[model samples]
Target: MDSEESRCFSGYDGNRFKLVILASQRAHELSSGAATMVDRQGDKNTVVALREIASNQLDLSTVFGLAVQRCRKYLEEFAGSRGIAGHSSHVSPSRSSRHTGLGKSFVDNKSTYSASFLDQDKFLSGGKDDGIKGF
Candidate 1:
């Protein structure tokens, strides 16, 4: 599990330091009642946040703010080389919780990720509850 988790730290161009900072910020958001951008999968907020970044399931702008513009050059190059128009969005577990009352399991057969969960503007302006911070 350590190896798997370590691989997640490389998601941000192998800059583990930056990845850690971003994950912590994302975890703070989760702990503050903001919906997750990815399935929780029984992991704590920190772990889930790490996995989200590792999988490119997160929009970098959400955590890094204006700093993301500087990083986008690399990402755009990587995406272009791989023929990816953009990162694919992942399903958040919140929708499933509505049907099963079990936030960790995927209960809805036709579940879709909420756009609100991926709102890039929320980090700086505060999230749905106005309690989440940008950094």
Candidate 2:
């Protein structure tokens, strides 16, 4: 049984740390009310633990996969809550967010960008009198 145990312990492709963690978890579960898959006539918990490890009952990759799924769910929930907590506007912002010298009505009723609505007199006279910065 020692050779078989060594073979099982060494056959694991992943890190030994992960394997020990998973095996210890499985042993705890087995010692609890969890059902055992292999035959258990007069087996001790150590034998059962080794057999469980050898039989591929507890896979580190599968455990990591489940943990990843749970982490993703938790992160998504956190992000969603943050979005709701910090969210303010369902409608669009005002046209003058920055200090741009333009008003809501500077563009015509059609859109914010109107090709024919040029302030040509202000530009040609070169005076500081656009009167949009007063607001």
Candidate 3:
């Protein structure tokens, strides 16, 4: 306990929780492509974080703010790139048809989504569904 207590920094004022959060956030950021502010002689994230915290290279405000910014950026990118189209979920047949060689023979033969399902109004809920009429 003596060594652990002695190695502690005055910046945290003995707040172990704050130290842990700061270190963990820094470590996460480091793992997510952020460069280390401290020199790391093959030290892993925990060691780097601890060294940064001990030397006051990291701060609580920066950690919390970075987390929020990264989260927002992730969500924006997520909404931006939802599918292969990378545009909208409701893809029209004409727009989707542009994707050439999408296993047309395989899809037509092996799946229920055959050529019969291509009608714009047939699949929609507006008209009466004549079951297997197109088949």
Candidate 4:
């Protein structure tokens, strides 16, 4: 390995395995159109990732956190597409429609509920109903 590559371990607190994993993940990001943190200098994505790590330019926490968020969003969409309800068992069903004065069974009305599920921001914000109905 190049001296820079060897130095990459320091970025992960001397954890060689973590350095490798994080570098590969960063390389994947580069290939997926993420901007490089270090100058490209005609180097491959893997090399750029290693250099960024070696120079301590990469934010490791953000890398791991973004991956987690992407996985969570994917799982939520997958569950919703499969007609699965809320992923958490602790949140009572009544909470989903509490502001609308609709009973828990309101979610069972697919015609009305589907729109809310698709626009999760509005549904989750707990705003008052607009007093309107779909035609």
Candidate 5:
């Protein structure tokens, strides 16, 4: 697979199959066979983890807890923005009376071109051949 696809697969946090595909792609790009072997091991670990999560062998809370722990680690490593944990209680404005803009102004419509056909013809011709020369 392409590098973009591999990156996307690596970024996937949802499924184990996706992770395996991504890891495989990365493994394939390795110059040394040793790196490929290491990737295979990682892929196997991901598969095992996925199976444990899927077969009810692992508790849902435990899975979520692990995910949260990993997310915390990532957050600490990246020092990125944290997510909100509580529900919002703020009142929303009524949809019908919602303010759109400050005010409306009546714009006067005007035509820049002259209405006379002769003026239009002259303007269009650039004062060159005025159709007098027969083809």
Candidate 6:
């Protein structure tokens, strides 16, 4: 029977794919009837440790992929819960200010626009060769 410490040590490998496989195997063995109850309990501990190792091994890209997947799944459920169709969250052209001239305030520069909008507005302002036009 593997000690709890040994199971934990087995998960310290730098490769996450191997850790996930190890965890899955442990989980299966723990849930199976082949081991004594005490050994099974130890396997369960190993399984948990392996899962933690797998999660820790995930790089930023992998984490981001998982986050995006989760967001897509839950966003549909969230929309449905709010009495809206999941697919109805489309980006409507009418809802965008680009075509509506709602961005005019920032472009005209009569009032100071927030810094976040300054860069895009500057591009829309045409070349610096043109003098500042008042609203």
Per-residue CA lDDT of model 2 for 1-135, tens digit only, reads: 457567766755544444454556566667776687677657776577668767866654554444335444654575455442223232135534663444333222223222221233432233545323532
lDDT of 5 by residue, 99-129 (tens): 4321111011112112222132332333454
What tens digits encode model 4's per-residue C-alpha lDDT throughout 11-122? 4544344455567878889999999888898889988888887887877766655544554576557557655564334335576546454423333442343333333333
Cα RMSD (Å) per model?
A: 16.8, 24.1, 19.0, 14.1, 26.5, 17.7
* lDDT on C-alpha atoms for all candidate structures: 0.55, 0.49, 0.55, 0.59, 0.33, 0.41
- Kindly report which residue stretches of model 6 are placed more than 4 angstroms away from their true locations once superposed: 1-56, 85-135
What is model 6's C-alpha RMSD?
17.7
Please list the residue runs of candidate 4 whose C-alpha ends up more than 4 Å from where it truly belongs after superposition. 1-4, 7-13, 70-135
Who wins the lDDT comparison?
Answer: 4
Q: How high is the lDDT of residue 80 in model 1?
A: 53
The digit string of per-residue lDDT tens for model 1 on 1-135 reads 257777655444433445555777778778889798777878899888887777777777657653344345544564456444333224344644464543221212212222232334553344343222342
Report the lDDT of model 2 for residue 56.
Answer: 66
Query: Where does model 2 exceed 4 Å of error?
Result: 58-135
Alpha carbon lDDT of residue 87, candidate 3? 30
Q: Residue 47: error of model 6 in Å? A: 7.6
Best candidate, TM-score: 4
lDDT (Cα, tens digit) per residue for candidate 3, span 1-135: 235434666434443544565577788988888888778878888777788767766665667456545544654564345432323344457855896544343233323222342332343222445232432
* Shift in Å, residue 114, candidate 2: 54
Model 5 weakest lDDT span, ten residues long: 101-110
Task: In angstroms, give how far residue 12 of model 1 lies from its true place.
Answer: 5.9
Q: Give the per-residue lDDT digits (tens) of candidate 6, residues 3-27.
A: 7545656745343433343454444
Model 6 has an lDDT value of 0.41
